[model samples]
Target: MSALLVQPLVGGHTGAAPAHTGLAAGHPGFLSPSGVEIVFVLVGLVTLGAALVTVTTRQLVHAALWLVVALGGIAVEYLLLTAEFIAWVQVLIYVGSVVVLILFGLMLTRAPIGRSPDADSGNRWIALVVSLAAAATLVTVVVDAFRATWIDLEERTGPGQGSSEVTGTALFRHWVLPFEALSVLLLAALVGAIVLSKRNSDAGSGSGSRPGSTDSVPARRNKAGES
Candidate 1:
C-alpha cells in the first residue's frame, strides 16, 4: 500500500526515532499521522480505481479520461511528498500532454466512439500472468530495499535546503541517462505517430480519387453528342 511508503519518510506510531532523528520525536508535523494516513489511503484508492477503469473500459475516449484521473492521483501523491517540481511535471507531461496525445490518436485513427467489442485481444490469461509476476517482483524488491529504512526529514533538509539539493544532484548524476533515453523514446514515438497519420491521410486521398473515374462518363457523353 502507498501508506507503507510514507512510513520511512513520516515515521510510524511507536516513537521509533534515532538520537539524530529530527521529525520522529518532539517536532510536530503539519498533519497528524492518522490524517495523513487517511488522505493517502483515499488518494490511493482513487488512483487504483481510475487505473482499473482506464484499462478495462471498452470506450477509447473514456479510457483516456480515466487515465487522466490516474495521472492526477500520482501528481497528488507527489504533492503530498512536497515534491512540487515532480508533481508539476506529472500534471504537465503525463496528464495533460500524453493523455491528450492518446485521445488525438484515437480520433485520428477513426476509432469507435462507443464500446469496441474487438478491443479485447483474448490474451487475458497471459496478460494476467505477466502482470501478477511483475507486481510480485516489484513488491519484493521494494520491501527488501526499504523495509527498515527511515528518513529524518528535518535533519535531512535543515535550514540549508539540503534535501532538495541532494535530490537534484542524485537525479542528475545517477538518473540522467535514463531520463535522456526516455525523452528520446518519446520523441521517436511522436514521430512514428505523425508518420502513421500521414499514411492514413494518403490512403484516404487515394480512396477519394475513385470519384474522379465518374467524371470520364460526362466527357464520353459529350463526345458522343458532338459526333
Candidate 2:
C-alpha cells in the first residue's frame, strides 16, 4: 500500500505523461492537413471558380449552368463537413429547384443564349469594389469569430453532434418562420419576373404594330382599301 502511494507521489503521473504527449502529437496540425482538408480546399476552389464564371459570363444560359455547378459544389462541401441533411437540402433546393427555376425563367423571358452586350453592366467596377470589400470584411469577421474553435473530426462523439435528426429538428423548430418567409419571397420574385416579362413583351408587340409604321401590313391594307 505504501509503495503504491509512494510511487504516485514520487513519479507524479510519470507513466501517464507519455500517453498525453502521444495524444497531442496524434492531433493533426494546420500545416499538415488530412485528406479531408485537402479535398475540402480543392472543392472550395472549384466552387469559387464556378461562382466567378456564373457572374462574369455574358451568356445567360452558361451563367445559369455555372450557377448549378457552384451550388452543387456547395452541397459537396456540406457533405464533406458530415452534414448529410444539409447537403441533400442544398442539392435539392438550390441546385435542383432554384437553378431549374432560374433556367426556366431565362427561357420564359427569351433571354439570349449567346453572348449579349446587354449582360455587360456599366457598374461592373463599382460592383467589384463593393464585393471585394464585403468579402474581406466577412473573411476577417469569420476568422476572428472562429479563431479558437476546433473540431476533432476523428474523435468519436455523441450521436447528437452532426446527425440529420438533430439538424431537421432544429431547422423546423427554430427556423421555420424564416424558411417560410424565404419561400414567400421567392414566390414573389418569380411572380414579379413573369409580370415584367409579360409587360415588356406586350410593349414590344404594340410598338411593332403601330398604325403609322410602314412595315405594318394591316395599316398598308387599310390605306389601300381607302384609296
Candidate 3:
C-alpha cells in the first residue's frame, strides 16, 4: 500500500497484463472465476456486438441508437471496474449528451430518415484489410508493452493505496492540456452543427419565399400603368 500510494507515477501498473492479472495467485479464491468477472465478460460481448452494429447498420438513426447502447455498455463496464466517476461521466457526456447532439445534427442536416444508400462504402475489401491490419498492429503493440504488468485492485482500497482522488488529481494536473483540447473540439462540433442548421433553415425559407408565390398577391400596375 505504502509503495503504490506514494508513487510519483509509474509502478507495477507500468504496463499491462491479462485482465485478471492482479488476482492473488497465493489465494485459492482468486484462482477461481468470479461472478463479477462473468458479468464483465457478458457486458463486454454486448458492447462489442453493439459497436459492430453501430458501424455496420445502413440506417443512420439505428446506427446512432446502437452507438448509445455501445457507449452505455462501456459505462457499465467502468462501473463494474469501480470507476464510478468515469462511469457517470461516460453516461452523462457520451450516452446522453453526445448521442443527443448527434441525433440533432442528423435532423438539422435533413439526413435520410430511412436506410441511407451512402452508408455502404464501395471499398469493402480495402476497409476489411485495413481494419484487420490495424487491429493486429494494436494487439501486437499492447502485448509487447505490457507482457506481465498488473494493477493491484486490492491495494487500491487500502488507506495508502492511490485511489480515485489521486487519479482525479493526476488527471486535472498532468492531463489538463488534453482535456482543454477535447473541450475545444467539442465546441467546434457544436458551432458546426449550429451553422449546418442555419444553412438548412435559410435554404428552406429561400425556397418557400418565391417570386410571385401562389399564396401571395403579386404587385401589379393598374390599367393606366401606374403602381
Candidate 4:
C-alpha cells in the first residue's frame, strides 16, 4: 500500500523532469544564463535591423526581401518558444503567399525595374519620426508593465498536447468565426487586385490606340490620296 502511493508520486515527479530540463535548455542552445540573454538580444537586434532596412530601402524588391528576413526572424522567435505550428504558419502566410503576391503586383504594374528617383519620396523623415515614436511608446509601455513580473520558463505537458493538433482544433472550433472572416478578407483582396489589374490593362490598351488607327476614312478619298 505504501509502495503504491509512493509510486504515483514518483511517477508524477518523473514525468515533470524532462519538461523542466527542456525549458532549462533555453531554445536548443544557450544553456547558460548569459548565453540565453545574448541569443535573445541578438535575435531582437537582427529583427529590428531587418525591419529598418525593409522600410528604408529604396528598391521595392529589396524592401520586400528585407521584409522576408524580418518575418523569418519572427518565425524563429516563435520556434524558440516551441510553437512550431505558429512559426510555420507565419512563414507560409507572410513569407510565402503575401510576399509573392506583392512581387507579382510589382511585376504586373511594370513598376520601375531599376532605381528611380521617384521611388525615394519626400515623406521619409515623417515616416521615420512616426515609426520611432510608436516603437518607443510600445517599448516603454511593455517595460513598465512587465518590469517586476517573473516569467516561469516551465514546459508543462497535458494529456495528448501537441502544438499542431491543439492549434488546428482551436482554429476550427472556438475560433472558426475569425478564421472564416480572414478567408473572406483574403477573397475580397484578391477580387480588388483582379479589378485593378484589369482596369490598368484597359487603360493601357486605350492609350495605345491612336485617333486615326481605327478610323474608316472615306474609301474613294483613301484610294485617290494613295494614287
- TM agreement with the true structure for every prediction: 0.60, 0.64, 0.63, 0.66
Query: lDDT by residue for model 2 over 63-109, one digit each (tens)?
Result: 99999899999999987887878888899899878888899989856
Report the error of model 2 at residue 70, Å: 0.4
lDDT digits (tens) for residues 1-227 of candidate 1: 76787765455533555433334454333333445556867999999999999888999899999999999999888766666667878899998888888999887567788899887799988998999999999999997665444433333434333335656877899999998999999899989978976884565557566877455655655675554
lDDT value, residue 155 of candidate 1: 36
lDDT of 1 at 154: 39
Candidate 4 on 1-227: residue-level lDDT in tens?
Answer: 96796666545544544433533322332244454456657887898899988876778888888988999999887766667798899999999988998888777556665665677668878887898899999999997654332233456776223378888897899899999999999899899978976984565456556555334334433664554
- Candidate 3 RMSD to the real structure: 9.3
For candidate 3, the per-residue lDDT at 168 reads: 78
Error of 4 at 67 (Å): 1.3
Give per-residue lDDT, candidate 2, residue 38: 90
Candidate 4 lowest-lDDT run of ten? 22-31
Candidate with maximal lDDT: 2
Which candidate model has the greater lDDT, 1 or 4?
1
Worst 10 residues of 3 by lDDT: 218-227
